[model samples]
Target: MTELDLQEYSHSLLLEVQADAEAEGTTTPEAFTRRVLEDLEQAGVVANTFTAYHKTHGHEVHGYGVSDSGDTLDLFITDFHLNPLDSKLGKADTETRFRRLLTFVRRCGEGFGQEVGESFDAYDMCAAVGKSLTEVNRIRLFLLSNRVGTWTDVSANELDGIPVTHEVWDLARLHRHATSGVLGEPIVVSFDPPLPCVSAPSNEPDHSVVLAVIPGRVLAELYAEYDTRLLELNVRSFLQVRGGVNKGIRQTALEHPGKFLAYNNGITATASQVEFLKDADGQPTHISRVHGIQVVNGGQTTASLHYVMFRDRKDLSQVSVQMKLTEVSPDQLTEIVPKISRYSNTQNRVTLVDFSSNHEYHVRFQQITRSLWAPAKDGSGKETHWFYERARGQYTDGLANARTPAQQRRFRDLNPTSQKFSKSDLAKYVHSWHQLPYWVSRGAQKNFNEFMARIDEAQPRVDVLYCQRVIAMAILFKAVDRIAASHGAGSHKSMVTTYTVARLTLATEKRVDLDRIWREQAVSTTLEDAIDDLCPRVMHVVTHPRDGAHVGEWAKKAACWDAVSRVRWAVPPTLEAELLDHPLDEVVAADDEASSAARGEVTLVSPEEWYAIERWAKETRNLEPWQRQLAYSVGRKLELGQGVPDTQVAQALHVRNEAHRLGFRLAS
Candidate 1:
């Protein structure tokens, strides 16, 4: 037969063989294809046997290419039928269920704290999300030492700059990060990394090297939710003793590579392939735990995440204040901020974030610096600084070192506006917020910088909505501040009238702080400028603890949150795009300029006399401004008699108004 005829005839025979196979308990495409290949091999039909297999597209992973030889398939040998015996060689089963994941992560974090003999911080919590303490803390930046089994080049001997402690701890960080994510990315670690140890002994110590062992991908999802940085750094430091290098291993490292490999086939081999033995088999192994787990644009996107280190409280004094606010209904915050909830750990050292009702414009207190508002000379917190704030605007806890607002503004103003900034500018801005690398405060800063870099350089250039969001957020904050301040400060008496009036009076529109984002890119301006335009809302500021023990005011109350705390809740791509432009108002038919302008309303009402007004209105079935004022006076007198603060009296009325709106009939 002619070669062409023979090829066609062969194809037909192969198809017949595949179609006639007897049923097995289970048969996968790979297994069936393998059977066909085996028969063909036995018949001695040479050339490229894979050619036929590639033609039939039936596999989880494979690539198609038009080669010089014509259409060809690049099949993943890894995608072949998994031989249970080969794949299971050294792998261990793990807890992959959600419940088990929750438990395991809790233990991983709590146990890490006990080991470190200190309370956990945001750094530790971040480590739980798949970062090593060191990497998350920016103790050392990730230098891609190896890719797969190959080493890549990093110019100028950057490795020389890293300290041994950072290198070792970094490995632990990477290990934790790997264990926390469901990453197809290789779970890798560095070991006994060659660097100058932070502290080394003159003679060889019992443990000089550091080992970083990562878990397989099975537990990655769970680990991804944690910040493994502190845990990783601490683990590395713990492992380092006075010997050779400290070599440590995680329980997860023992799992076989096959679990991570896509296909079960061809995973088994002689020990040489895997170098299967643990520490006893070779040199100290270490890898950055959180090195690969990136935080994107201040937690805006997941594709790229960078480091946001913390601010050290030791470098400067701390301060705070609380403003009682007029109680407003959750609906008034619709499209505005909804319900705000908070939670604190038992020690109150770490506070998880607060979620808003609509889940927009949420807030969280990562760390609370001391009361910087106190008397500079008195040292006691008796002096009330009485700082006014637009909470919703670009609010910062307290920069690494907050000098005068003017000084910071000048420093920011001097920055050149001409850098071709995508986010590198933001990174530098964030990085500048740091004073030292080792300090805990620097970790969050590093994280913020890293997150920005990640988004700016994401695979597809992470969306720009992250930039616009801060502006709208800033304006609302300022407006809220104003409205609340003019109204009531948590006084029950003014609760109903002032708060309800404020809601009805104002309009909440999304507006961008253009100067803060595009040209000036100033932190203070981002906050002060936007907030200055809005009415100040009443926010309670708390000062020194009655016993120097209280960490935050709303701690113990924050509980019962299920899903993970989101850094940037995912907003639809289109909505985020819209965020770039400043929010404008509807233009009038006769005046286009008016469309760009925002309309303001006033809400300067009292809540205390609301009850008296209600009583008067109920009896006369009519309402008047005079009657309302008298009612407020009556309520205020009653509240004063009870020793309740004026603010409390106002808050009561506000709460009553909200309740009444919700179908609650308050007693006249």
Candidate 2:
């Protein structure tokens, strides 16, 4: 917030960019832009396909991401400067850069790829944009810079009749985002005519509830403008399925518009602030505007409204939908928003792990990382913690909490910035090692959601060994990234890295001795050699897409992984020599054995408890049919005064644990 603080953040960010550039053998500007894009992507400010392209002509594009719906295109341009944290980006320079990016978009729409060959890095981006031009309804031009500047807001314009908006994320803005833990800028919605709403009586002082019947047409229009920003708190994206809720929504909108209110579950929304339009009698009559409005639930309904209005060309004049808007205070936004989202989505198939940053898995993982220090690497003689940022902005918040420079330095010493990894980073590493490179390529947030779903189902124990293996995977991923960069992977660096690691994991059959890597705090030279030998093959498969498809999009497909998996590259003998004799299962079994020993003896449940558990599970519908049957069988065995097998006891315990996780409360 202060000038000194901004300068410090800028300097730290610059250093990080330089370090990444050095590691990847890339230019500082390229690294800086990539880092910024990664932050924005994780923040949900942008979607997938982050390709870097630069042109020397009056046109240039640092990077771009197409929204999940393929209707919004985000174009990024950066003005990165070396040193001089006090440097300022003026309006003239900003406009010049903006125009250059605009020219690039215009050229793409005008089929500029025909002029340049496919060998160029920008060719794929230009071609993809050109192909999606018809579907793209909005263009967001972002100006990323490390310099201090007064942002001159650009009014929304049209690009080939499609709406275009401009935004700038300068040093101060990035610093604020890093520290504040908020996802991008707040979306302020101003109603032109204002809608009537009734305030719900709430005794709570920190928040207020309002009920409104929003016109379906107005809701569609709002979604058309805000898109996913309105659903930032929502866990899922637009399902886009023809059946289920989407189909029913479309049918209701078309056949029984007036019944939509009675048929639909409506939407649960939250906002930081709201303005009321009051009458002369000092009674609030209309809701005028909302600040930081996010639909925590009913994202499907909101997106369906937009879908029907645009894709089906259906008039929503007769449709009205109910809405419950909770105006939360800024102080409670972080604490209450996720709870609101979680509880509202419980009725759906969404589980507790869907909103899982604060889940026990991550909490235990974070605790393990904090307590378990990694071995000193490169003769540093001092161990460091691989800080697992379970929540966003935690590492920075930790540094901020240090207050003084000395404390901050000690904090950095104990937890190096390079060692700091977020939940998405962990997901990417683990998923790549698990041979799901396609999932890794699906962007951070989505891939993380998928990974969390798996964690929810598997319920893997998070212990010291698990933390070590995760860090080992992280080290492997980073090593591959560096190798890919050194080999001039260019825009395909990420895909190449993930695929190469995946191929190695597959070739080795999950026997790579992650414990050794964890002990050394680095990868073996033989393993690095194996990765180096396979990087070129992976790059070839990634760069040469069949039918000349976009490499980025191709990498996100299972077929891409399939093609890479079938490559003729074999694991080097030396690398194979480094692999463990048994698979990772053996290691996990050993850990389970030690964990079991630590817990002493497993107490067998009494027949009464087994019967109670079975009854509770059946009543709550928490267990699958097979699990319920197993529980019932065990209960029957206990009732018959017959001994139950240890397996059956374990099964019953698992069922009980799962039921507890699903919120099946029992009388103590």
The lDDT values for all models are 0.23, 0.79
lDDT of 2 by residue, 406-514 (tens): 9988998998878888888898998898787988998887788777765653456777888898899898899999999889888878889999998988888888989
Lowest summed-lDDT stretch of 10 residues in model 2? Answer: 594-603
Model 2 stretches with alpha carbons more than 4 Å out? 278-285, 351-355, 403-406, 586-668
- Please give the distance, in angstroms, between residue 566's alpha carbon in candidate 2 and its true position after superposition: 1.4
TM-score of 1: 0.18
Candidate 2 root-mean-square deviation in Å: 7.5
Q: Tell me the deviation in Å of residue 95 in model 1.
A: 2.7
Tell me, by lDDT, which candidate is best.
2
Query: What C-alpha root-mean-square deviation, in Å, does candidate 1 show against the real structure?
Result: 30.9
Instruction: Compute each candidate's TM-score over C-alphas.
Output: 0.18, 0.85
Residue 468 local lDDT, model 2: 90
